[model samples]
Target chain A: METKGYLDMDLLRFTTAGSVDDGKSTLIGRLMYDTKSIFEDQLEAIERSSEKRGDETVNLALLTDGLKAEREQGITIDVAYRYFATPKRKFIIADTPGHIQYTRNMVTGASTANLAIILIDARNGIIEQTSRHTFIASMLGIKHIVVCVNKMDLVDFSEEVFSAIKKKYQEFSSTLNLADIQYIPISALKGDNVVDASKNMDWYTGKTLLQTLESVQIISDYNFEDARFPVQRVIRPQSAQYPDFRGFAGRVEGGVFRPGDSITVLPSGLTTKISKIYNADVELQEAYSPMSVCITLENNIDISRGDMLVKSDNLPNVEQEVELMVCWMNDKKMNPTGKYLLRHTTNEAKCVVKNIAYKMNINTLEKIVDNFEVEKNDIVKITLKSAKPLFFDSYKRNRGTGSVILVDEFSNETVGAGMIV
Target chain B: MSYNLNHLEQLEAEAIFIFREAVEQFENPVILFSGGKDSITLVHLAYKAFFPAKIPFPLLHIDTGHNFPETLIFRDELAKRYGVKLDVGYVQDSINRGTAVEEKGLNPSRNTLQSITLLEKLEEGKYDAAFGGGRRDEEKARAKERFFSHRDEFGQWDPKNQRPELWNLFNGKKAPGESFRVFPISNWTEMDVWQYIKKENIALPSIYFAHDRNIVNRGGVLLAESPYNTLLPGEKYEQMHIRYRTLGCMTITGAIFSDADNLDKVIEEVAAARSTERGNRADDKRSEAAMEDRKKQGYF
Candidate 1:
C-alpha cells in the first residue's frame, strides 16, 4: 500500500469479494461513514429502518444492499455499486455478493476493477472462499490484490494469527502473475485500519485502507503506448460557418494522438494524415487515453462508425477467429451453433461459438476440458469465429479495445462478457 | 490543430460523441429539453456536436402545465436562437382526453401526469429515440441506469433487462414500436455539470441563479409559490433569496437559500454541498424508489 504522497482527480475502480460473513459491507460502510460520504438524510433513513427491524445498531450492510429480498434476508444477493470520492480520487466500489449462486455478478464487477480486495475472517482464514476469490481475481486480470485479514478483534489482534494467514495466501499467490499484493490486518466490525490506523496494531507497519486508496498509482494502468482510436461517429457540421468541416469523432482508447500524425482507417485500409483535432472548435495539440476528440484528415477518405484509426505499423490483429475467456452472465447455456451479437470496441458483428475449450473450477484452479458445458456463471475458455474480421488485441494489451460482450439477439440482452485470450 | 482538453472539456467531448452517435443510429431522435440547467447544458453540447451545422434533431418538452413562466421563456429563446424545432407536449391535453387524471387539493401537481403526455407524443411522432440529460450521480436507482435506455412499446423502462454497454459500444437494437432513451451525460455529476456550464459559458434559465422569489416554508422545505401550488391554511408565503437545484413544475420543485448568484459561485456551492441536488425535488420525497418507479413507467 502506497501512501507516499497525494495527487488530485485520480480514479481507481476496485471490487470487494467475501464469502458469507467476512463483514465486507461493514468495511465499505465504515469507509463511507468515516469519510463523510454518507449523507445525513440517508443515515437517518437507515437509522429508522434499523429501529423498525429491532436491531440495536444501524445495519451498515443495508447501505449497499438496495434490493428488498436481500434486506429481508440480511444478505447480499447481487452486485450493487457504491461511489464515494475523496478530494484526491474518485472511487467506484463494486460490492459483489459472496454467495456462490451470484458468481456471475462477482465476475461482472471484478472484470473491470483495477484492484481486488479479498477479505478473510480471522476465525476461518484462507478457506475455500478465499481461494475462490483469489482465483477469480487472477482470472479476471486484476493485477493488484489487497488481502485484508478482517475480524482481528475476535482473535485478540494476534500477530501470529495474521502472519500465519498471510504466509499461506502468499504461497498460493506466487503461482499467479499478480503485479502487486499487499497484506493488512484489520477488524471491520470495530473500524480498525480501514479509514484510520488502528491503535492496537503497532506490530503492523502499513498505510490504512483509505490512505492506500488515495495514494495508489493508477495513471500507468492504462495502455498509453499504443495509439488506437475506434471511430464512434462522423462529425459533419455542414452549416455556413464551417460547411466543409469533416471530422472522425471518437474517443482515444490508448496512446496519444496528435496533429500531423499519419493514420490509417482499418477495415477500409484508407491512409490519411491528421489535419486537425477539435473538442468543439478549439484545436488540440494532442489527446490521450479516455479523452474524446474529433480528428480531421488531410484527405476526404471514407470512414464511418465501427472503423479503427491506428498507426499503420503498429495495428491490432485483424483476425476472423478469436479465442477468449468468457464469463457467462445470462441464465441460458451457451449454444455452440447459436448466432450471437459480438461487440468489441465500437464494432458489432455476428459470431458463433466454434468450440468450448475448457471450464475453470472456481475453488481449485483446474481446467476441465473433457465434459465441457458453459452453464450460467461458468467462466470458460472458448473459441469464436465472427462473420467479419475484428481488429483487436488481447484483453491484457488494452482493456478498452480487447474486451467484448456477447448479446442474445432473441432477448436483446447481453448474455456473456469475454476477454480475448 | 491539436488541442489539450481540460477535465470538464474532456467530459463535454464524451457527451458530444454520444449525442452524435444517437443522431446517426436512431431514425428520428429528439432531445428532452426541460429548460433546467442539465438540459440547458445538453442543448449546448448538442449544438457543439454539430458545430457549423444545425443540430440534427428537434427538442421535445413534456410540459407539465405547472412549469415556471421563466423556464418556458428560456426554452423558446434557446430554440429560436439555434433554429431548432421545439415540440411541446402538454399534460393538459392528456387530461382533456381523460388519459391522465390530475391530483386535486393543495399540493396539486402535474409531475406524474407529464409521462402520459410524453409517451403519447413520442408515439404520435414516431420518435425512435429521445435523448435525456439525466446523470447517474443524482440518485441510487439512476446509478443503475444505462446510457442507452431501451423502452418497450408501452414506454416503460426495464432496469433489469438493460443491454450491457461496453467500451463506448452502445447497442440501440430494439423491437418494432420500441424507442430508446439516450443519456449523453450519464457519467457526469451535478458539480461536473455546473463546472462545464461555467467553463463553456452556456446560457441557462434565470431560476438557476439566486433571486428574490415568493416562497412558502412547508414541512421544513422552501417551496416556491406558483399558481399551481394551492397553499395550506397555516403555510405562510415570504420573499427569500433562493435558487432552484432543479427545474420541473414549480409546484414540485423546491428552492434553496443561497447567495451563489453566478455560474462560478453555483459551481463552488454545488461542490461543497453535502446533500444530493435531487433531494430538493419534493416528488422524490414520496418514496425511496420514486425515480426508479417513475422511470419504469417511462417518466423521463
Candidate 2:
C-alpha cells in the first residue's frame, strides 16, 4: 500500500442506516476487506464463529454485531462505530440499526456525520424505512446523502430497477434539505460497484462508492459566513510564570476568526478584539470551524463557559423563548409543563415546555396538529421558556449552535434532542 | 481559504476538548495510568490540554503487583516529570484485606484483581470521574462504550442503557454515588495511537521495542518468562526477540516476535501487521465475551 498521503489525509465520518437483510454489514465488510482494514486475526475469528453458527457463507454481520446479546439476537442494539482508512481519507462508519424503535440510535450516529448512506433493498423499492431514515438524516443537518440501492444481484443487475428506485427516492426527497445526493447500484454480497466498478452493470458511468466517498468536496460543508465561538473553558494560569495569561478556549463552530477581529461576547454584550489565536502553542493568523483553539482578547472581560463570541457585524438572535423540533428519545413521555435542563453549546439553562405545537408524521411528512402528547420516537415542534436567554440561529443556518439536548432534571438523563427553529 | 487541522492535530484537539470538559463537569477526576502506550499518550494529551499549569487531576495507577519493572519506572518518572500527584492502588492490598481472591491455576493472573482495587480506590477517594485509555477499535465490547460511560452505584456498565452521545455534547450526568468513565481517545485506533506517539515523541517503556528476552509459548502466544508466570509441564523457556503490543499484568500480557525497535520501524510494522493488538492477550482469549463480562463488572 502507498503511504505518501498518510500524513495529510483528511477524516470523513459517515453513518449507515439499514434494516436486517439489507446487507449493511456486508457492504461495510467489503469496504474493510477491499481497503485492507480487516486484520487476519479478526477475519479468522469471524470465520470460526460463522462456522460454529452453521452459516454456509461467512456471516460478515457477526463482525459488527459485537455484543453478546446482539450476536445472540442477530440484531444491532446500539450504534457500533467502525473505522477504516484508505490512502486518500480516513473513514469512521457509525453503523446504526434501521428499526423504527432505534430512531434515537440513528439520530445519535448521524449527529456528527458528514454524510449519510441510506441502504435500500432493490427488491423493495422506496420502503417506509427509507423515507424515515432520509427524514432523520435531513433533520440532523447532514448535507450529503448516498443512496445505495443494494442487493442488485438479486435483481439481475437491472438498470431499470436501479433507476426506478432512484427516481422514486428523488421524488420523495425533493422536499428535503439535502444538498448533494447520489445513487449507486451495488451488490454488497457480490462485490459489484462498491469498491470497484461492476463488470456486470456496464450501464453505470458514475464513480464507485469508495471513489465518490474519497473525492467528495467536504471542506466547504461547514458554515464559514457567520463566525460563532462558544467558550468551553476559561484558561487562566494563575502561576508565577506569565500570570496575566487568560485565554478563552473553544472549538470554532462556524466561520473564520483571526487576530485583531472585533468580536462581541454574547449575553454580556462586551466587545473586544482578538489579540492572538493559539492552536496549541503556535499562534496562527486565522482559525475556522471545527478547529479547537484558545483566543486571547485585548480586554480581560468577565467571560467564562457558555458565553459565545461572534463577529461584531454579524450577530445571532438572543432570546429566552424559542421554538424547536424535538425528537423525544427517552421511554418516559414528555411533560408539557415539566422543567428540563436545556444545554446548547456549553451553556445550560433550566427550561419548561410551554406548549406542543404539533407532532410530525415522519413517514408521510405531515403535521398532526391534534396530537399533543410527545412520546418516544415522536418528533414534535414545541415552545420552550428558558430561565436565561440563549444565543442561537436556525438549525438550517448553523447546525453547531442551533442544536440542544434536553436533560430530565430529576433523573439526569438526556430525554430529547432539539433543533432550534 | 481557512486553516484546517490534519488528522493527528484534529485528534489532539478533540482529546484536549474532552479533558477540559471532564475537568469543568466533574468535581473530582483522576486519570487511570497503566504505563501503556495509550495511557502514555493520554498523559501527554492531558499535559498539553492544561499546559504551563499542572494537570488538574491526579494520576491513579492500579498496580497489579505483576507489572514490568520498566513500566513502573516509566510511570513514576512521567508523573514526576509532569509535576502531577500520583496515587497507587495495590492489588496486593486487596488480596491481603481479603477483598479479592487469587485464581488457583497454573496461569493465575492478578489482572482481574485490579478491578477490585480500582473500584475500592475510587470509592475511598470519592473520584467522580476516571479517565481511561480505552479505544473503540481495541475490542468488540469497547466499540459500544460512550465517551462518558456511566457506571451505576455498584460500578457496573449497562451497555443497553448508555446515554445517547450526540456530536461533542457528552452527557456526564449521573445519580449520587454513581460516576463516569471518560475515554478521551475513544475514537483513536491502535495505528493512530502509534502515529501520534511517533509525531509527539512521547516516551514509552523499553519493553515496547524489540529485544532479546526469555519466553515460553503457551496457547500459541509468547509469554515472557517471569516469576509471576508458572510454566506448565513440557514447557521450556526459549530466547527470542519480542516486543509487547499491549501492557497489562505481566502474567496475562503477551509479546509478539518482532524486530521493530524504533518508532519508524514500529509504525511500518504496525501498518503491515496482520493481527489486532489484543490478539495475543491471554485474558481476552479466555472467552469470546471476556471484555464484555469484565466491563460489566466495572473492570477498566
Q: Pick the candidate with the highest DockQ.
A: 2
Over A1-421, each residue of candidate 2 has an lDDT whose tens digit, in order, gives 3556677878899999998678898899898888888888889989989998999988878888889999898889999999988888888899999998898899999998999999999999898899999999999999899999999999999999999999898899999978899999999888899998999999999999999899887888889989999998888878898588898888888889999999999999999999999866778888887887889999989998999999999999999999999999999999989899999988999999998999998888899998788888899999999999999989888888999999998889999999998
Task: Choose the strongest candidate by lDDT.
Answer: 2
Individual DockQ of the candidates? 0.36, 0.67
Candidate 1: regions farther than 4 A off = A1-8, B1-14, B50-52
**Regions of candidate 2 where Cα sits further than 4 Å from its true position:** none
Candidate 1 is graded, for docking, as acceptable
Report how far residue A192 has shifted in candidate 2, in Å: 0.7
Q: What is the lDDT of residue B217 in candidate 2?
A: 89
Global lDDT of model 1: 0.82
Clashes per model (N, Cα, C within 3 A)? 6, 0
**In CAPRI terms, where does candidate 2 land?**
medium
What tens-digit string does per-residue lDDT give for candidate 1 at A1-421?
Answer: 1111212255577999995589998888888888877776677767888998998899887677665556678887666667776777667787788777677777877876888899999988898878888887887788788999999999999999999999999998888777888888998878899988999889988988888887776667777778999988777767677788888877888888889988888999888889888776689888787777788999999888889999776888999999999888787888867889988887889999898889988778888978676788788999999999999988888887888889899877778889898
